[model samples]
Target chain A: MEVSARNALKGNVKALVIGAVNAEVTVEVAPGIEIVAVITKSSAERLGLAEGKEVYAVVKASDVMIATD
Target chain B: MEVSARNALKGNVKALVIGAVNAEVTVEVAPGIEIVAVITKSSAERLGLAEGKEVYAVVKASDVMIATD
Candidate 1:
């Protein structure tokens, strides 16, 4: 399911999406960037996870993409 | 430009591909997982980077996908 894609984004970056309460969302990004993985509130609570919790942000090289600005 | 994708891979992993001796390739992967970003040899060595070099492995959360087995 891997495909190449790109982003118009530049500079340090991170991603966050709204998540259901108690669920943790994985916010994806690289270090030096502000964010990476996030957990929804519900999932976070359910798993007893919280902010600054250590979760792995996984991606394959194939998933990495290059794009034009 | 990013999209969601999935992988069937398990356990720690790392990716390496042929590259020119001068450049460093970014092998993409997550922590706890073995491999991720890979740079071609030309890119890797050209940048004067090597293994254990700290480069951010970047990915947007939207780029990550969960799929059926």
Candidate 2:
């Protein structure tokens, strides 16, 4: 089964990439919404991310695919 | 404008809700990707969340939106 992308919303989680590592990354974002994006450590640093930056916090609806009980 | 839902993936962020507190909520999720979701604090606790629990980490692609400077 497939869920419409609309079903995966976490509300106003917008941000910018302030830091990046291979697995762990940080987004400066706006307001107080600083999200520490956790990914592969190598993927982090390789992204060459840093301070005063801008990057989309890309996520897959399917990867965000959910199941509950 | 619209972004294909495919472009929003954060890879393996899949999880279950183990806790909720209106503004801050915790998801059991799978693996080590426990997302500390920050919403309206009331939305958190109202969810009446707890340990050994299950809940969908609902997020919107539009709300997960991005902009650069």
Candidate 3:
């Protein structure tokens, strides 16, 4: 599928925590570099996500924030 | 400042494109690895963003998405 989000880091699912409404997914894009994502539980089920599965962590440019040190 | 977002990539602003209500900022986190972010012009101004300024590209876990190939 074509995704508009500019960032798409390929990684393997490291962990998953399912709550009432949201599911937190941790993807390790690189060695010791992980991206954590919180998506809806329904979406998690739809994606059939599980630990060790390969996935991409997507983030839109608009949702990104600029911060200073 | 303490940011709750897990991902805070350090980079320098490579470019800035200001629009009527939004500003697009490009941050080069690593050589040839750039992350583009679109934020409100007001926020950009408040942050004093400019090319060559060091900044962190932040994103909340909730705003992240998981995609498969």
Candidate 4:
């Protein structure tokens, strides 16, 4: 599917932590660079996500934030 | 403020496109890598965003989506 999000990091599912409503997924794009995403458990189940599975962590531009140090 | 999002890319603002309600911000994290974000105009105004300003492009874990290719 085509998405408008500007960032798509190809990675492997490093870990999955499921809760009652949300599931925390860890995607390691590089050796030590990991992007964590919290998605709905239903979505997680729909995606059939598992450890070592190849997936893309999609982030929408509108949801991004700009901060100063 | 401390954010729980795992991805915090340090970059400089490359451009700003402001609308009536929202503003599009482009941040260059690396030499050729840029991350774009659309934020509320109020927030942009509050942050005093301008071109060449150093800022961080932040993404919340919950806002991230997982997709399979």
Candidate 5:
């Protein structure tokens, strides 16, 4: 519930693609803006991830790179 | 330039806290949804990251987890 990372987006699951060991989850936080998270297949199944399911794409990384053009 | 991870958030740099070796960057992706990324100091300087700077918060993780209530 409590996390050190300050970013939290509320969105509905748009797609779920499960592979042998990893699963890609797409969460649409805003219109036309979506966040994709790659998690373990076991965790995906444990979370019961599917389209239309509401979930939080928790990203807690120490190395968030910034890019510009 | 090209990454396999799918989450790319378009946001402006809101805040930047620099430390000895790493810097914490805060990006406002939406009205109230902000994401925090911790990156290296050198990388921060290389990217020229500052407040009001436009950038993309790239999250490429092999273990992005899903959370629910």
Candidate 6:
């Protein structure tokens, strides 16, 4: 699929915490570095996300805030 | 800063393409793995995001969709 978002991190499904309306998915793109995504519960079920499953955390935001200290 | 979003990728500013109101920021978290974020021009300037500058790409989305094929 062709996505406009430039960031595409390839990783495995480390963990999935499903809630009533949302699900928190943790994708470990590298060692000790993980990307957590909050997706809909239905999308999680539809995608069949589970531990060790391979998936990409697609982030398409019009407002990506930058932080520096 | 305490953010609700779980995904926080640490990387250096690889590139920045500024537009009139929005700017595309490229953050290279790992080798061959980069994250692209679209942020406001003012925010970009406030954060002082530029090449070689280290920053964190904060993505807080209520709808993070999952895809599999």
Listed for each candidate, the true contacts retained, as a fraction, are 0.11, 0.22, 0.89, 0.88, 0.82, 0.70
Candidate order by DockQ, decreasing, is 3, 5, 4, 6, 2, 1
Q: What's the lDDT for residue A28 in model 3? A: 86
Clashes of each: 57, 31, 0, 0, 0, 0
Identify the candidate with maximal lDDT: 3
Candidate 2 lDDT by residue in tens digits, B1-69: 333332222323232233344234445434444444545544435555455456655444333433232
- All candidates' lDDT scores? 0.36, 0.40, 0.91, 0.90, 0.81, 0.79
Per-residue CA lDDT of model 6 for A1-69, tens digit only, reads 778765566789988998999888888878988878888898888888899998987777564566776
Q: For residue B19, what is the lDDT in candidate 2? A: 32
**Candidate 5 chain A — worst ten consecutive residues by lDDT sum?**
A57-66
Model 4 regions more than 4 Å off: B30-33
lDDT of 6 by residue, B1-69 (tens): 688865667889999999999998888877888778888899889888889999987777553445565
Question: What's the C-alpha lDDT at position B62 in model 6?
Answer: 54
Ranking by lDDT: 3, 4, 5, 6, 2, 1
Best by TM-score: 5
For this target, which candidate reaches the highest DockQ against the unseen true structure?
Answer: 3
Poorest lDDT segment (10 consecutive residues) of candidate 4 chain A: A27-36
Model 4: per-residue lDDT, tens digit, B1-69?
A: 888777887889999999999999999877766779999999999999999999999998988899998
| Model 3 lDDT per residue over B1-69, tens place | 697998887889999999999999999877776788999999999999999999999999998999998
Give TM-score, chain B, model 2.
0.47
lDDT of 2 by residue, A9-59 (tens): 222323323334424344543343444455554443555445555564544
Please identify which of the two predictions, 4 or 6, would achieve the higher TM-score against the true structure.
6
lDDT of 6: 0.79
Model 5's chain A TM-score stands at 0.86
Candidate 1 Cα outliers beyond 4 Å, as residue runs: A1-24, A27-58, A65-69, B1-16, B20-32, B67-69
Model 3 pairs in collision: none
Per-residue lDDT for B1-69 in model 1, tens only? 333322222212123345444222333234432334444555444544444444434445444432111
What is the Cα-based lDDT of residue A3 in candidate 2? Answer: 34
